[model samples]
Target: MNIPFYKMHGIGNDFVVIDNSVNSISLNKRRVKALCDRRYGIGCDQLIVLSNPKNDLADVYVQFFNGNGDEAGACGNGSRCVIAWLYRKYHRTEFILQTNAGLLPAQVIDSQMVKVNMGQPRTKWRDIPLKHEADTLYLPLAGEPSAVSIGNPHVTFFVEDLSTVDPVFCGKVLEKDPLFVEGANISFVQMLDRQAMRVRVWERGSGLTLACGSGACASVVNAVRRGLADRHCQVKMDGGNLIIDWDAENNEVLMTGPTSFSYQGSFDLDHYPL
Candidate 1:
């Protein structure tokens, strides 16, 4: 069996995108995991399946999955990549896409740049799906973790230095700690200045990854709530930099970043037989 795909990336975070709109392909957990395997398949942090919108309310619907095979509600970078793919294929300047997280409005700010309205950030423990009840701005986990939900759950831990902390150890412990039932992307963030910070992520099911856009957005929102950072800040991840802004008046968060297309091709799925 063969399938068509487009490998795209934003910063260093990458995805394997399938045009399910035209191709009759169904993504099972095992097949998605197999395709994302670095050694045995096309390596990627997540797999995004793009299908035609189910109604006039949306232009596209994205099904997202972590490399570990768990279905994810939303992904910021993946959303941007999907928009780019749609823009490139459909030549549209603006569009609305439906995600597991909810409706997302996206537009091409310029060639290779996109702005995404990622909706509101959830700060309540119930909303973030954390077991403990408290202000999400300050929750006790392994370290200083701020629970915020952009599209999915994220625990942003602020550190003074990026080099001092060990992500492998911290990320593993905090990701599964009973606080977050569905697990969370752990972000160790170090403030560089009032408006900039360095971030590293142990993505929920993907483990350590180069970047996480939703994580970045959540971190800024947490920082602002805690008075650590302003409403607009730059989150520098391993992959690259992302600008996050929260509009208090409207209760919406906007993330802006650059996206890239690595290449386009069809793959033989025989190696990952379902």
Candidate 2:
């Protein structure tokens, strides 16, 4: 089967987006992983599939799969790119995006930038879905990481020096730790001040990407909960920066960042069968 796709990115976290509203494009784990292989296929950090909304309130339904072929509940940057695609199709500035995480209200801030309401952060043990109950603000683990769930789970370690923490090593260990029933996205955060911070993310299945959108939102929420950052702060990642606002008025996390389309094309699944 030949699949049409749009290659897009938010900051530097890229995705292969396929619209399935017109024609259903089914993918299995192996095929999804193969499509994300840099040498063998259309490489990207994740694959985004868009289809007609299952819920009446949403404009479209979006699903995200990491390069490793694991489906994720929420993707901050992926949602932005999806919104950008929708804007080109409908010429609309705002709409509701439905995902496993829920309905996210998205908006177009400008030509290059987009914003989305990512809902409130989930801070309880059951919400983060830890295997065992532990204080989310200060887990009884090494590095005293904080847990926050925007849609997926995240464990953030506040560090004084970003260079000292090995994201791949630490992230791998903590991601699969027994503490987190569902593997967690690990972030090493360094506070520049109350209004700004630097972050490096080891995404659950994508490894260390240039940026992780939900990781950034989790970082800000964790920082504010720990009294290390303001409600609104700037999170700088390797790809670029994102403005994350943990809105006090509505308890929603608002993320604003730039999204771009790299190209668009079709690939035959038979050519690279994994």
Candidate 3:
């Protein structure tokens, strides 16, 4: 079957967005992994499906799967890219998307930027869903990581320099740490100042990417909880900068960043074996 798709990205975290509004689309594990393969298939950090909303509260139902074919609860960057696509096609700026995490309200600021209200940060060991009960503020682990969940679980380590840390080695170790029952996206963060920070993330299923929206949001929230940064901060990643604000009053996270369309095309599902 020929499936139409849009190739887009927010910062450097790209996605293959498939519109399933008109036709029902189904993807299996092998197909998802193949589609994410850079050399053999349409490359992307995640595969997004836009379906007709089941509930009246949302404009559409957005689902995200990582390169490994695992469905993630939330994807901030992917949501922004979806907003960009919806805006381009519908000429509408605001949208309510229901994701696996929950309802996310998004806005297209302009051609280059989009903003998403990422809802509240989940702070408790049980919420982060760690294996044992402990302080989320200061997880009793190596590097003294702080745990936070912005729809997805994350463990942020405050480091002096992000470059010095081995993302692959550390990520492989910490992502499977016994403390995190569901595993976790691992991030190394450096505080530049009260309003700026540098971050690098090893996403749980996607491995390392140019950027990670949920990781950025969780990092800022963790930093703020630790009194390391202001409620609003600029998170600098390898791909680009994302403005992550932990709204003090509303207790929600607002992420603003740029998104771009690389191209648009169609893929044949028959080309790949199930």
Q: Top lDDT: which candidate number? A: 2
Q: Where is model 1 more than 4 Å wrong at Cα?
A: none
lDDT of 3 by residue, 20-43 (tens): 896576778888899999999999
What is residue 58's positional error in candidate 1, in angstroms? 0.8
Q: Give the range where candidate 1 is weakest over 10 consecutive residues by summed lDDT.
A: 135-144
Order the candidates by lDDT, highest first: 2, 3, 1
TM-score to true structure, per model: 0.97, 0.98, 0.98
Q: What would the C-alpha RMSD of candidate 2 be, to one decimal place?
A: 1.0
Q: lDDT (0-100) at residue 96 of candidate 2?
A: 98
Backbone clashes (count) for model 2: 0
Model 1 RMSD in angstroms: 1.2
Regions more than 4 Å wrong, model 2: 272-274
lDDT of 2 by residue, 1-274 (tens): 7778999999899999998887686678898999898988889999999999999999999999998899999999999999999999999999999999999999999988999999999999999989988999999899899999989999999999999989998888888998899999999999999999999999998999999999999999999999999999999999999999999999999999999999999988687565
Worst 10 residues of 2 by lDDT: 265-274
Taking the tens digit of each residue's C-alpha lDDT, what string does model 1 give over 1-274?
Answer: 6789999999989999998888878678898999888888888999999887876799988898899889898888988998898899889989898998889999998888998999998887898898768778778754657898887898888888889989888889888988787888898889988799899989988998888889889889888887889888998988898999898898898889999999978888777776
